[model samples]
Target: MPQQYGTGMSHTYSTTSSSQPPMGTGTGKKHDGYPTYRPIGTGGTVGTIPNSMTESSKPVYKPTVTYAQTSRATVEPKSSSSPGQMYSKTRSGPSSKPTHTGDCKTPGGLPGLSKTQQILLSDTRADAINNVLTKNEHFKFSFGNKRTGGPGKGGEVVPANRKTFPALTGTGLGMAVVFLGPCGFNTPHVHPRAAELGIVTEGTIVSSMIPENGVNVHNADGTAPREILNTLHQYDATIFFQGAVHSQFNPGCGNATFVAALSAEDFGTGQVAQELFGARNNAAVADVFGDAIDGADVDKLRGAISNNVALGVEQCLKRCNINKRK
Candidate 1:
């Protein structure tokens, strides 16, 4: 891959040449286009994925239509397909108003919009854009600040998705800057609506994925656990297929940062263990264990699951000297 796509790589890859090339070789980025089913390593860099499609190129998300102001706005019946069509068909064409085009194209903010598009955008979208320009807010339904390494615990995730950044409504793209503290774990979760391409920018991350079970001829029983994807370091990239339960953990004693780009505007997350145990169904939880668990111990499990970020390999936490926050 380095030889084919990355002449700038420190040690260029080759069939005849060694994986480590001569020391004086030209150096820059890695473009290791790896496979998904095995090591799950991409060894990627900028311009890596070829001809990637934008949001508009994807299946347009058609949300359930429920309008409190349907009649008030003369909206088309509750059967409108796309959210864009729902909002746009009711309005006229583009406004003559000047918009925010690359710093107004002049001084005094003269030609720029005081706000986002008036005619083309709904009020909901305008407010979302304004907040993004002016404030530091959170993505939708962050796990009460605890799951992200807790308050002042150093890990953080800044996400830009449909609910958080409305400007990307039809863009078919969402991303997050994931910062993980020592032994910090981004829990096993599924993005139901989108596939994610993630690149670790700092530190080492141990990533794993449990694919949806089916008839795998090699491992037909499905009792065995899926293998760890890889221990990815700087510039290493990986892909999490849609609806695959995957996780990234900081294995070192310091910190790690990664960028995850999803091919959806509203890529929903379902944290597996937390969602399963945090629900209000204790009897069902025990039934999964064939009622082997005592009712009292079930409560304890729920309490522990409540602190999502506190969950990680015990050995890793001990090695990192990271104390679990409450």
Candidate 2:
């Protein structure tokens, strides 16, 4: 920052170098074409920098920027398991935080994984999380410090959640990639914690979203579900709001792929069809159809909920010359 000369109470005058002379005359002498300063206050200092002073001459200024200062006490992980792995924690996570194992990995707060698979998920997630932190080398592969989802049947979904990559926690961003085979479909689902910005990276697919109406869509309120649809070709993009019911279907014969950047690290995915049919109360679930199907046949439909990546559009399947799978 440029040095300041003012000390007392005075009008805050900017040290603006002007081509014109000061409003009043200046006490300092003008050398070359440099503007001069005049004493016109009692609170702040007033000084003029010469337009022609060399770095070694009259005034000197140093950089006054302080970067990346936070109020959190940073704690480093020192363990025999994950040596040299480091993380900066703000300690702002939920008060019921899980025990921090070695390698900067935690076992709680992962929306989906923590529910039923806690015992099974802890070790698997720890390994994956550690690999991301330790194997991310500086160049032999970082050739640049910068180098570089979920899907259905022929489709694949890779969700980059906190469990798989603990670095993503509290980052306000997450990712999931989906691949769809010819006539493949990504079933209707809602991400309770995240809004998604999706980009089509390959082939073509139809997408849709239905957000809650007005203040919020509630099951108790019997809010009607309204869906809006759009088609995305290669390189096209679209967005889905949090809690919106969304779906994607590949219309072309070739494989389709899309990447979704979500707004929350633990964004949870609930496939609508699976959740609706997954209820143990068969009568209650079957009641949703209300006479649409015979009661005797309802039992057969119990486990028939289509997979997230199931076949879509038999016409498209025929056009693509892909055999239907049972």
Per-residue lDDT over 1-326 for candidate 1, one digit per residue giving the tens place of the 0 to 100 score: 11111221121212111122222223332223432111111222222223464644422222222222122323223322222332222223455564554443222233443322321243454454454334444333342342444322435566777655645566688887677776655655789999999999899887777677761334665455454367799999998889987777777777788889999978887767646675435655433221121111223333323223223345566676655432
Any runs in candidate 2 off by more than 4 Å, and if so which?
Answer: 1-152, 213-225, 279-312, 323-326
> Which tens-of-lDDT digit does each residue in 1-326 have in candidate 2?
11122431121122222221233323333444545543222222356765588655643211121122234433332222232222223334455556665434334434444322443454564554453344443112211122122212445566777655555654577888776766666656799999999999999878877777663344775864555677899899999999887877777878888889999978998866557666444665433222121112223332432222232355566687766433
Each prediction's whole-model lDDT (CA): 0.50, 0.53
TM-score, candidate number 2? 0.45
Candidate 1, TM-score vs. the true structure?
A: 0.45
Please give the lDDT score at residue 28 for candidate 2: 39
Give each model a TM-score: 0.45, 0.45
RMSD of each: 31.9, 20.3
After superposition, candidate 1 runs with Cα above 4 Å error: 1-154, 215-225, 279-312, 323-326
Using lDDT as the measure, the top candidate is 2
